[model samples]
Target: MGKAKYLSAVEQGMVVGARRTGLSVSRTATLLCFSCSTFYQELPHKLTEQDRQLLKCVLHKNHLSSVTTLTTEYQTASGSNVSTKTVRRELHEMGFHGRAATHKTKITMHCPNSLLEW
Candidate 1:
């Protein structure tokens, strides 16, 4: 038995070694300078079917629409009850642009004839 040898290599070197190696997973991982368990753990997890659908809908619905309008429509159609902040955060995450306009419309739009009482 002798002292273990450790070689220093950049991240790119490890990737190239992994691609060229024809060995067991553990051996490949050791040559790449990483643990086998860690190598497998680095793989990305797939999104659920529901999440995929939601993402597709979000991407196709509007490109530059107001966040408030999108949130309202999503809530009305899906009944998910997400907050305005969540909607804004999602829009930001998606890399959408444009500022949110201030809402200045009257509270009540339908008003019939009314008599003044002075």
Candidate 2:
């Protein structure tokens, strides 16, 4: 019930496997090749200068670019590699769905049908 460290699904599965095998935490940590303290501690990733520049360019100029475009541009401009998925994930975290607009038909709405005949 206490605060859980930031473990991925794979790491969680590893922990579960260790528990199922009746190995001690230290043993599990050893098997994973990471210190027990490191396993339990959360290490947050800070944004790099390139990432800050990306955010800045997007916000300052109202930039609208696809994940592929962003990644291509970023690599060209910053001389670093970036995956399209990472760009997309960052956009989603920033509340951008990376879509022009979501489609919704009138049939999906529950408005009064009589309005259609009027």
Candidate 3:
């Protein structure tokens, strides 16, 4: 199978329309790089635009904060006791996740005596 893909509303509508026009489900899904199961499954409640904006602000203010802290901050900002998992998921969807630069040591090349002769 190909990599997972998230389709937009228009793309999903096209899929449904394509299926109605006698296109094979697998073929249509493969063309769009989408999974058939996800196409048919109903998604749960998604964060609204306002909620996402608030979350973004909170995240920016606490860039190094943990998921639990973010969740609490979001709740205080938006007056909703959202779950930590939900906050984490929204953060991931918004392209925010834990990542740190790897530490590296400087490298030095040893000079060859034979090559040093002028």
Candidate that scores best on lDDT: 3
Tell me how many clashing residue pairs each candidate has: 0, 0, 0
Residue lDDT tens for model 1, 32-92? 6666665544433233346435744864677566667777776776667777676665555
User: Residue 12: error of model 2 in Å?
Assistant: 13
User: Model 2: runs farther than 4 Å from truth?
Assistant: 6-50, 58-62, 104-118
Candidate 2 lDDT score relative to the true structure: 0.67
Pairs of residues clashing in candidate 2 = none
Candidate no. 1 TM-score: 0.34
Poorest 10 consecutive residues of model 3 by lDDT? 37-46
What is the TM-score (0 to 1) of candidate 2? 0.44
Ranking by TM-score: 3, 2, 1
The residue-level lDDT of candidate 2 at 22 comes to: 99
The lDDT of each candidate is: 0.59, 0.67, 0.83
**Ranked candidates (lDDT, high to low):** 3, 2, 1
Query: How do the residues 1-118 of candidate 2 rate in per-residue lDDT, one tens digit apiece?
Result: 5555577778878877886899987898889875677564643324575685675575445467556776677667667676877666666666767456878866766669798878
